[model samples]
Target: MNTQALGVEYYLAGMRAALDDLPPNEVAEIMEDVEAHVAELSTELGENETLEQRLGSPEQYAQELRQAAGYPPRTERLPVTTKKQLVTRPRVAAWGLAIATAVTLLAGTAVLRQSAILLLPAVLLVLSLALVHDRGPAQQEIMDLPETRKIQQWLTPEEGTPGERALTYLKSLQPAWWLARAGLLGLGAVLLASRDILGFLFIAGIAVLSVFAGPRAKVDRRWLWFSLPASALAIGLLFQVIDVTANNLAYSSSRQVYQPPAMQSYENIYAYDENGKLLTNVLLYDQDGNPINAPRQYYGCNGDDPQPMIPANRYPRPKIDYENGSCYTVAPSVVAPSSTESAPPSSSGSAPSNSVAPTSVSPSK
Candidate 1:
């Protein structure tokens, strides 16, 4: 139940019970006073008995009146739509400037400050933008017009209005407004139930405002119930920043791409293979053979295959034939020793021979 109806119930029931303790005459006076006030409201609201029947019990009716007589402010308890539009110009400017500033700060420092602790600014900005109110006319401007007067008159029909019946329809909607608000609160609760702690806190705060804001506003219009869902929007936007940031952090830290040794070979590949062609390319994959699509370094493989080193070391190194001191690429007629010294010539006047297992060789480029 909305605070309006709920409060109304307690008011009337309490008043009624309290009256029971008074002298019979005083009890009669209380009933008469209540009846008089209701009659007054009925007259103002287009006195239609049918519309009044839609309003719940007498206790509920009396409670609504009691609330309008200056109940506690219900900032934390208004329905979503009935929420006061705190989004005014300076506040809007303030929020806009604040957002722009934050974007700049985050962009500049996100790289320099890796601490997830930047959440402090994010949360502070949210609360500041929400709670600040240094803008707008000090109070909402009440409209002044002949039509407004007409509307009020029609709503609160005089003892003699020609369309009492039409006004009655408007009057009948009052109770429905309360029920609609209650439904809104129910729906909000259903949604909040599935959310996290922050979400629940946001929803519950606004829902409480929903139940009481309308009554506190002393709104005479019956359609105010339509504005309640806006509370959910406000609360959702308020909490989404935190939720989104956390989600992004989780995503960024997972893993890097896969580069392979074959890719590394792409960089320093400089040799001819047995086929007399350059072996500039090599393919690498996991046991599953699914290609790893990253730079070779990413896979911790810079083309450092043991097979390639074996060929480069054992084979004669390329040398520039020193004819006229001109450089020419050719296999060395003699192999150089690793210690930068010439190896002793073989007795048969040929390069030393070796017995090794056969292996596949691709030409270098």
Candidate 2:
């Protein structure tokens, strides 16, 4: 290769490594621009003049490019001692709290039925906020540390790997997740508020705040204190709703399986004769020749003194208070009998006088 060609290749190689942390498309564009600029400069170079003399080192050129592009300055790799000092105790504690918060939040979701589990994540989140506050301006330095940069790089997805693809997919879903988080927070507010209108409005306002905070937190790390806890609470509420819904469905299924259709909501049966006089001890039977007894075990006046009645095929049963040894008839409503009601002749060919029989019955609770 010619001297100029070798110089260009060496410069390009160093530039590529220096800009490795940038997006691939951005790096490619930068390289193209630099290559063209170098070619133009080479034609104007005098004898004994080198590319390094005109453009400085490749790292310096890359730095100027980053500044022109409005990208943050590239962080250089730190020596072992500097790296150790950069990983301050406060930063380490803050990261630990963050991890603990995530773990507890996930565990809380798994055991949403046990609401107490939510407390741990909440406590961890508080600790994280406190640590961030204590770190103050130094927090920025901690974030810029080599270890932190390495973690960020690892988290950023690259092409052609399953884990990377998964991470990319998750990142793509962030906007949708933000909206869902708001909805979850609103739903949780409704549940916690129950019937209190003012309380629901107050909590719903927080959910609305989350809607704005969620997107803002992505661009500004300072918003994380509010966004992180809000998101965790929203997740907890979502899982709690799921847990409650599941339990209710299970209970409803069991009730449907075990309870007889006719006996549901049944409390008492009232019988009346044609003259509107309440009937007593009126026997009841089904078309299949089976006796229809009361479904529940106990009946009483106003449910004050409940006492079991002997299971039998009888309507208009009396309420017995065993404690006071008293019996009273349950008269829910009165109905007038038809004026044309008449008795049929007896077996002896004589009509009975003033004889009545229950003609209809109704159940009530």
Identify the leading candidate in terms of lDDT. Answer: 2
**What is candidate 1's CA lDDT for residue 135?**
16
How many residue pairs clash in each candidate at the backbone level?
Answer: 26, 0
lDDT of each: 0.39, 0.61
- For model 1, give the 10-residue run with minimal summed lDDT: 355-364
Q: Number of the top candidate by TM-score?
A: 2
Q: Model 2, range 1-365, lDDT digits (tens) per residue?
A: 23455476577767867886775456656765676788898789888887878897888888888898898778664434544575565566557556765765575364323434545665666766665554332244345546776887899757789989999889899888889988987876666565655546655875899889877866555467667766776776777678888999999999988965453343345555666456767888889988887644333235454444555567655433233433333333333343325432222222111121111122334
lDDT of 1 by residue, 273-334 (tens): 45443333344345786643321111222333322222332223333222332333344343
> Each prediction's TM-score against the native?
0.22, 0.45
Q: What residue pairs are clashing in model 2?
A: none
Q: Residue 95 error for model 1, in Å? A: 29
Runs in model 2 deviating more than 4 A are: 1-93, 96-100, 103-127, 133-151, 195-205, 260-365
